[model samples]
Target: MADLGLFGPGTVTWRVHAEPILFVGGLRSLYLQALHPRAMAGVAQNSHYKNDPWGRLVRTSIYVATAVYGTTAEAQEAGRRLRALHARMRARDPFTGEVFRIDEPDLLRWVHVAEVESFITTARQAGVPLTDAEVDTYYDEQRRVAELAGLDPATVPASAAEVAAYYESMQPELRVTRDSAEALVFLTAPPVPWKLNPAVRLGLELGGPRLLYLGVASTALGLLPTWARRLYGGFGLPIEGFTAGLSARALRTALAALPSRYVQGPIYQGAMARAAAAQT
Candidate 1:
């Protein structure tokens, strides 16, 4: 039988993550992560995301895919690589002028919570049909991922209530910084490539990228929590849930309509095959 990875085929993580709306989750995670000044500082100093934005996105997507779908050995190796990377990376404190490891427990916990919360909320608003219990299960399951990232699972939030408390406790610490502002600008309208800049800038023949940028970016921004949106200059006006839901459902349906070859990459296919093999 093939290795079915950590959650295998039976877990909520499998179902929740398999949806196309996770693309929005990924973007939403970034929008949420950037609001933390310290977290954003780590990225600003240690990551080349600024120079290679798409590459950074692809790498992050690949890591999450591998962690979720890879065989046991594959997942462990990915975790090992992550621990080693985090061990070696350092960031300077923007306010205190102190040096710190990028993998400090508080930092890791913040990033992990931000990511888990972003993915879960995005799934819910995108109409993924997760029950409250399933949502809690998903959060509990994600502790394994936090462990993989060198965080102590015990320190991570393990249920919906815990996650909410964690966020409430974290609210005072969340704020924009110079690093975050720069990242937002880049993420909002990333530099058009030298080759395509003219056409894209002129709106001549290349409108697709611009439209996609606006669509995904706006939807992700709208999907942020009321407090997060407030930090980003939004009034959190009532709530953007209605419009965001419409956008998320639309994106979900459209992506679901894509050919399997386009929607299901090698990681997903190989995992599904291994799952079937194990059953047989």
Candidate 2:
């Protein structure tokens, strides 16, 4: 069998990506990505995010899982499929009437940085602590995913300092638009599949998903930088570090209590099998 995808056991990428806490990061990434006007436009116009938020989440989760845990061939195939999809997506800026491709280098870089940073930040804040060096390594290792998105790995931020600088320089381009508001609303309580809970349809109908989303999104929002929070001024309460930390720790513990068969999906299990085989 092929070796574990680009990342394997003992790698910082593996350690960070393996945690269930990263789901909070995924929520944070979408919030931050929407703050970029062009990125939001691409998603709002060209993506089915509004109509099928759960499906979109599942697809994105699968892609990330494949990159971190599947074989080299699997990762490459996933990348190819994503690139082909992006190549056909075009969007127009509502403010400037500027036309751009979703695959544009800069746009791809923005989405890439937002996502990996969210993952790393959420992990650190939510109890999966990393040393300073390991944090940098995680950022550096994620450049492979940036490259997979058709971005130049060299242009992707490879260190904590660089990522901060990148965010600072790009702040001028980030703003809250109509799409941003819509994304926030959609993500705050995206429709859960009725099939996922056949027995509790009545409970689901009584705002179960909204209550759950509020908890998840509060942690995610609290993890955002002060500036990003300011951009979302009336959205909700300000989440301080201590509060986010406690919430994250609780979430991690809850997930850890689940059985491995329920928590570790096929991609994770496949990687474990490969690692075990390599050891033998």
Candidate 3:
């Protein structure tokens, strides 16, 4: 096992350097959770690995790692390693008795898109200026991964408009009543744990900012009259009230308290500036 302490500073510093990534990732998780009732069902049906535990854990870990590291070679390496670990888990399907491959395209596509979109959207939200070319490049890379998984590359949307359309088509599959924007919040939150890995463990620890953000948002929504929350929820604006009510002080506190390996101030400031500038 890698020394946890050695990895600690890198992980923490990474958390700071990668806040935009985290934000988008959190939103993506929220979207998937809100959408996929069959998420749990898929695991039970398709997963042959015993208990389907490690597979889910490693997948989430990779997602977190990708978010913190961006879509660079380092992040890809982390994902590759995690994929190997997942492939080692062995179990047979009760019905088909088929063994599962950790690198299955369906699962890989989900991870790839979630991470890519998380990085892109978070950077954009933070105000990072991205050229159309940059956005296209990111989309193309994700599409390549999707193709590798045997999914239609066309199914990977090329623009924001396409993403909106795709989400519309998927509305029936989603569990939440929110619109795409609100659904994004849930899609990118931390994933539910199915198994444990160091990366995932670290992610859970480093998830303080996201958890705080969501908690405040949820509470704010609850405080509104029931009709208001429901109305907004109907429009897919679940946390608008809560986000609006957030104080600068609260946001600062949450940012400061987030567990990260690096000196938080500089990294966070850089990320914030980049976000502001629209540099995804």
Cα lDDT computed for each candidate against the true fold = 0.87, 0.87, 0.45
Deviation of model 1 at 256, angstroms: 1.0
Cα lDDT for residue 143, candidate 3: 64
State the TM-score for model 3.
Answer: 0.45
lDDT of each residue in 1-280, candidate 3, tens digit only: 2222112222323333344233334433334433333332344344543344346545655445443433344445555665566556443433355666544554455545545555565444444456766665556645644543345787677665665565456544444332333334433343445455977767765777557656644533333322334434544354653452343234334555767644233423433444445533
Better model by TM-score, 2 or 3? Answer: 2
Count of residue pairs whose backbone atoms collide, per candidate: 0, 0, 33
**How do all the candidates rank in terms of TM-score, highest first?**
1, 2, 3
Error of 1 at 179 (Å): 0.9
The digit string of per-residue lDDT tens for model 1 on 1-280 reads 6888887889999998898789888888888899888889999999888678878888888889999999888888999999999999988889999999999999999999989888988889888898999999999999999999998899999999999999999999989898888877778777665565575666833578677878888888888888998998888974586688789888988888998898787898899999988888
Least accurate stretch of 10 residues (summed lDDT) in model 2? Answer: 233-242
Candidate topping TM-score: 1
- The digit string of per-residue lDDT tens for model 2 on 131-158 reads 9899899999999988888988999999
**Superior by lDDT: candidate 2 or candidate 3:** 2
Look at candidate 1 and tell me the lDDT of residue 187: 80
